[model samples]
Target: MTTSKKHGSNTALVHSDYQAPEGFAAFPVGIHHASTVLFKNVAAMRERSWQNKSAYTYGLHGTPTSFTLEARLAEIEQGEHCLLVPSGLAAITLVDMAFLQSGDDVLIPDNAYNPNRELGDWLARSFGISARYYDPMIGAGISDLIRDNTRLIWAEAPGSVTMEVPDIPAICDAAHAKGVLVALDNTWSAGVAFPAFDYGVDIIMQALTKYQSGGSDVLMGAVITRDQTLNARLQAAHMRLGFGVGMDDAYLVLRNLPTLKLRFDAHDASARKVAAWLQTRPEISKVLHPALAECPGHEIWKRDFTGAGGLFSVLFDARYTEEQTDRFVDALQLFKIGFSWGGAHSLCVPYRIKQMRQHWSHDGILVRFNIGLEDAEDLINDITQALESLDA
Candidate 1:
């Protein structure tokens, strides 16, 4: 900004003549927060468009901070575009609202993240849309389920909690053949373990709240796509929904991204150790970890995923009642009881598998583990003590 004639103190304070030098360099991306961006003149304002990331129109569209984060996320996921929203579920909502209209049909995995399944149910109940659930293991068999009205299919690399890895390629192939678009909840892999695009997924939704934030402090989500036309549709929905993320949260996710893979690998190693140990225990009937042989669709995981991060679940022997299993969860000292994962602190959550799924063949109480950066032995010891509580 150039200096103008001296004005009142209030005006001077609001429009400072001092401008910082331009040649600043830093490792961190600068946080640019602005609700009302200024333009030199009406001409400049008229030229700026929200869809054009090269310039800014308003805060809701995006500032430099959010643009940088989106660009980096897109690059990491091997996608061409990305849109940020307030929460992971919001990202799912954006895709749903953008693509599926009245009279459209959508297919969701029976074991998808509960909120996703709930959203599908809500769409079906409230809107004219037809939302249906399919078995995660359906693979190419999903082709038979896709109706002529089907517009979208939602896939989770591995169904939440139960940890059954789906055959993404087969599902994608079938969906593509039927002229349907497939969207994957790639939050489990954090774009580090699974490359959704390579497997033919049309859209990728990530919960930056988890691994990307690393501190478990931020709540944000991103939707990425390689097709410009598809991205245009998402951007239109984003604008209409007014989905804007806080600049500070965007910066936090940006800061931790550098160490995301490192933390993910550490978590992976510890989880594998803990899961493998549980496999030998008499108390555990199954360890629902994609990397483990006992996990459903383990072979599919091996074929598609490059890595399995910290999250996994274990089923207590049928002999243990829900009350006893709850006692075991409460007995743990180090692993705090909570929902969500991907932070330095380990978390444990128990799920009524039968209630969550349309069909559950397993016969035991399920407890999920989010292994953190803690020592593998220490986590194992904590579980040991917690296991003793089941008998108490």
Candidate 2:
């Protein structure tokens, strides 16, 4: 049976025809775990040797299941191509490895995911490449940091810990003017919240382990690009590094992709409610959420992004001590203290900005919150009790 019309969102879910046909029965496009793929002939083998996104010769190159996931992700990002990696950090590293060489410079926001920033610093020390930290709110002012050797600029919206939303379009415009490539760690927005390619980002990287998987089980990342040339280069780098995600992980993300928009909207609503409630607490200094009117980059986020996600941060009043913060966290029955968000269960982590940055400083104790799918009333009650614990 051939599907002629364009499949709608629900149609895609109902139609299990995404797989190829076998002799008598249709094999569902399940997990295709492979390291070495067999070719039809020597001619086909020679043709498949090159990593051009067509035929797969090796497992590290890609399997049919991986290709399907990549295609679906590219469609979601509205990009010309997409490449999968073992993890989100691997995706960041692949972008750095593919674009930067010895003596080249890359610009990273001070509020970037700590791992990416650390990787850049390590690369600078080990590979002779240099990475300079810029303020997340710099916007077009990033031009001042661009050097002749600058090859790439990394941007993260609603940056980690601080939750400051950057002026992504302004940064992209400035970077493109200098012929320097712009790559965004778009895990916060999950591609559904904000379309990076539409905003002029040459390369878009996402950690599927977060919102894309919707569960805390899978670890995956993707590098999407609108430029075919840049895509080719990234694919070559991915191939060389043998960076490939598990077929099961790919299947999990693919299954979750159908409900991504709905989940994102739910997260946005729940997060706004929680952030607003946190603001009313006397012990809370500020609520760092992009969708909120008082956030650092509310105007920019309003102008660029279509929505927000579950991730946001809160600063406690200066009067609160570390012991108080610990007591509050320990009192929470619903919010688990853990790393990584975009999962089904809510989580909270107290962070020290002084340790995370060199150029920036915040005086109050900051706690990042990840709102989950639980009832908003329950979450609110949990917070209320947790805050009460702080007072007692």
Candidate 3:
């Protein structure tokens, strides 16, 4: 006989013919923060190998918290599997380490994040692997750079500080034709503005420390892949490296995921407003924002990306000296001078293009601006005042 319990007009089923075993009920979030998981018996422990997702043997392999975070991230990127790493750069390294072998070559965009480019150089020197730089605007022409030993191709849409949007689909198609895997540093778009997987990328790497945390306090990265085999390889590499993150940081990123869309939209609107204003300024020579119609690769940006983010750079008119550029950055009252953006507060950083590029030409000094959630008018006023200070 089955009996049902009712409370407050809601009925609950209590079947006498059925029984729920111990720990059968599901926890709401499954916040299992543990280094070692206990098993019911020796047989269960031996059967619980680290190969499968449900079986957890060690914390570095995964805890319930990390697993939950991975699942949520995979959903966010529309990936089949996801692996979390210590930092965004670590995610990049994991992908490289997972695929490339000694004497193999990896193609990197010339305008890629500096740290990533540096890592490639280091990997070449240390691991006997080779790294080559290709123009960010290579498109289908990237086929020219492919060698028999080329194993991986790295893509960064709207290339780092210069913001040159690439023909991602064309590049991906070309890379895949050669049986080379493509990995994108999707930090700028935060997976919300651009769907990396939809464009035929095998792996999507994001710095959760940036938009995902939204607070700038945590440093976290995620490698998301739709290919199960690639995911397993990345996971195995991650395990060999002893990659693990704090449970609190995972919880913080999870908490912020709900508001990612809202924050991203706000950032996009503010950045577009600011970039538009800078385009008309006398002191500004060029604004390297892909969303701006005048910016290079604007057409490709329009074709590929859904929206933009708050990070953009402005090249000062050739008339302004480096000291003048420094003064302008120092004159800003609201914008903080710092490195690494995607935080709640506005930031400004000066750049020297001669140091950042190998083949690109620079007309003047450049300053990267990270627009925050402040009022657009107020932010504009701050910039106007800074430009005025440049004149003074």
Q: Whose lDDT is greatest here?
A: 1
Clashes of each: 0, 0, 0
Look at candidate 1 and tell me the lDDT of residue 62: 91
Tens digits of per-residue lDDT for model 3, 1-392? 45544333333432243465676664346466888787889999989877688878987778878888899988988888999999999999999989988999999999999999999999899999999999898899999899999999999987778888989999999999999989999999988888889998989999998888999899999999998899889978998888889888898888888888899889889999999989998888899999987777899889878889889998999999999999999999999998777778999999887797888787989899999889989999999888887878
lDDT of 2: 0.88
Instruction: Write model 1 residue lDDT over 37-138, tens digit each, in one string.
Output: 989999999999888899989999999999999999999999999999999999999999999999999999998999998999899899989999999999
For residues 1-392, what per-residue lDDT tens digits would candidate 2 score against the true structure? Answer: 66636778788777756566576544346688998787898998887655677677888877888899999899988887889898899999999999999999999999999999899999899999999999999989998888999999999887977988998889989998898999999999898878888888889999999999999999889999988789879978987887877888898998898889899889889998999998898889889999888889999899888999899998899899989998999999999999888888999999877888877666688899999999888999999988988879
Q: What's the TM for model 3?
A: 0.92
Q: Which candidate gets the maximum TM-score versus the true structure?
A: 1
Residue 322 error, candidate 1, Å: 0.6
Score candidate 2 by TM-score against the native.
Answer: 0.92
lDDT of 1: 0.94
Q: After superposition, how far is residue 245 of candidate 3 from its true place, in Å?
A: 0.6
Q: Model 3, which residues run further than 4 Å from truth?
A: 1-30
